[model samples]
Target: MPHAKTTPFAMPLPDALAHVDRVFGIGTILADEGQDIVAPYYVQSEPGYKRVHSEKGCMHMALNTDGVYTADGYFTQIREVADQIRQVQATRVLELGSGMGFNTIALAPDHGQVTFTGLDLMAHHVSTARNDAGHLPNASFRQGSYTEIPEDLRGADVVFGFETLCYAADLDAVADQIAAALAPGGRFVMYDGFRRADFAAAPQDVQTAARLFEVTTAVTNGFHTIEAWDAALRRAGLVVLRSQDLTDASIAGLRYLHNRSARFFRSWKYRLLRHVMPKYLIRNAVAGLVGPYMIEGAGPRSGDTMGAITYSVLVVEKPR
Candidate 1:
């Protein structure tokens, strides 16, 4: 079992595939065409996100900067949002897909003068976030999708979504909405998984791993490339300020999840529990197990360093 020392994955790509196949056959990993599974997926996966991912209710990836996994890694996206707030001197912030109000709640207390609004598609998530944010007068949560931001919520100084935009069905429509929602000179930040520009050229196994990761997490249509997002934003009359690949920083946390998910496949007890659990919830293990392989390529043995997907940050701004 050879490993890629450059990556945080412990098992080789072939071994990882075997583990996933043992639990959920690889042939059955993809969703049927035009399936509306995102909302239900989140509903079923909330508990898992709270327990396995973060107790604070973070549903996004933990970004480790020094190649070490730590609880602080969860705050990486938060810090980026906070920096944008200060940079823009923002008084109003809107977070798209603000799951459980993690980002808004964390920033509201420190910026007392700033008002924070978090919009999510899940009513359960909004209810939970509202409960969690009861103490913060400056923060509020609403149940809504980013595809059609409400008219009253427009003119925000900062608009961001952490690991949520990948669920977007139409990039052009969402980009237009974001541009319309932001005030002049306002910033829009998104952190999520994206297909590499050369995704079609990647190995078949790597492509399969990327698609498996997408379907398990309910991104049934698949991740759009960064280039597609950038072009869409520009067409909507926004400036693309940054598009940084943070895949290296995500390795440690992804590997941690991969190892944890591997346990469910290796143990008879955990495997049995899958029958009792919600199908979407139990299938999360498939995403966690294949996540690292999709982003880090098969392994050193394959001599393929070009991965099929990347975790990245894209920043754009509405013109003044």
Candidate 2:
């Protein structure tokens, strides 16, 4: 069962689904006619993502290794981000959208000199992360949006997020906010998926899937293409230090998700529920959790390359 906190919503479907269906080559469902799907809350806070992490006390979207569902793989992502922070000798680190404090708690003990402060949008997530990181004195968490960096939170030596910025309603706003929060020469590192620059030029089927993935993932306006990312960073007056496409490396974990979804869909319990529950509910359940992954493949694929999106690591530095 999904985590109890991961509540499902049946909002009036917005006009976005048709575009999604057209992009991904899927037929429109009757579910889109009246009540559509929407997740007003954070995607990481969703049942599927949260339930898995609640079991092991860590939640992250990036894969640590091929076929590795363990928290270790997630930690590998944390370590990479942490390593980047360390290289720049940042003593004050801010993690925007630090869901459940997994990254904060994981990196705090290892680098005691660097104070890790996590800011999240959900109060519940703040509480949960604080409880999880209670033993780590170097770690702290607060409830807030990354788009609006409070004055006192400014001047961080390093700021980062893993698949978090996609929650922003305005990527440009987020870029500007990060720039304002960091000290001169401070670094900002992000690991997230982005649409390809030529996504619109992709084959019709790929375009539909890309749109579907965006709507289903609740990142419709927030998911930026790589080209958009560069422009946004530069516009915010931050210099791009490095941008590495980790799409291939991230595929293993995605494949694992596909396998898991296949198992769940094939389960006898789910089969029985199909007849017992309302069709819309089932559709919402799958659309909320499974559909995004299906369109995106097991991992990141370029918009024109057949996958819904591609993942990348972008490191930028504020001018001194």
Instruction: Name the candidate that leads on TM-score.
Output: 1
Q: Backbone clashes per model, in order?
A: 0, 9
The lDDT of each candidate is 0.88, 0.64
* Model 1 Cα lDDT, one tens digit per residue, 145-221: 99999999999999999989988989999999999999999999999999998999999889988988989988888
- Check candidate 1 and list the clashing pairs: none
lDDT of 1 at 88: 96
Candidate achieving the largest lDDT:
1
User: How does candidate 1 score on lDDT?
Assistant: 0.88
Candidate 2: tens digits of C-alpha lDDT, residues 1-320: 33211222111122233322332224544223222233333443345455644453455554544433444566666877777777889889999988778778878988988888999877777988889888988889998888788888899999998887766656788899999999998999888878777566555544554554455445546367777778888999999999987665554454444344444444677546556654333333334433333334322323222555677888899999
> Positional deviation of 237 in candidate 2, in angstroms?
1.3
Write down the worst ten-residue block by lDDT for model 2. 4-13
lDDT of 2: 0.64
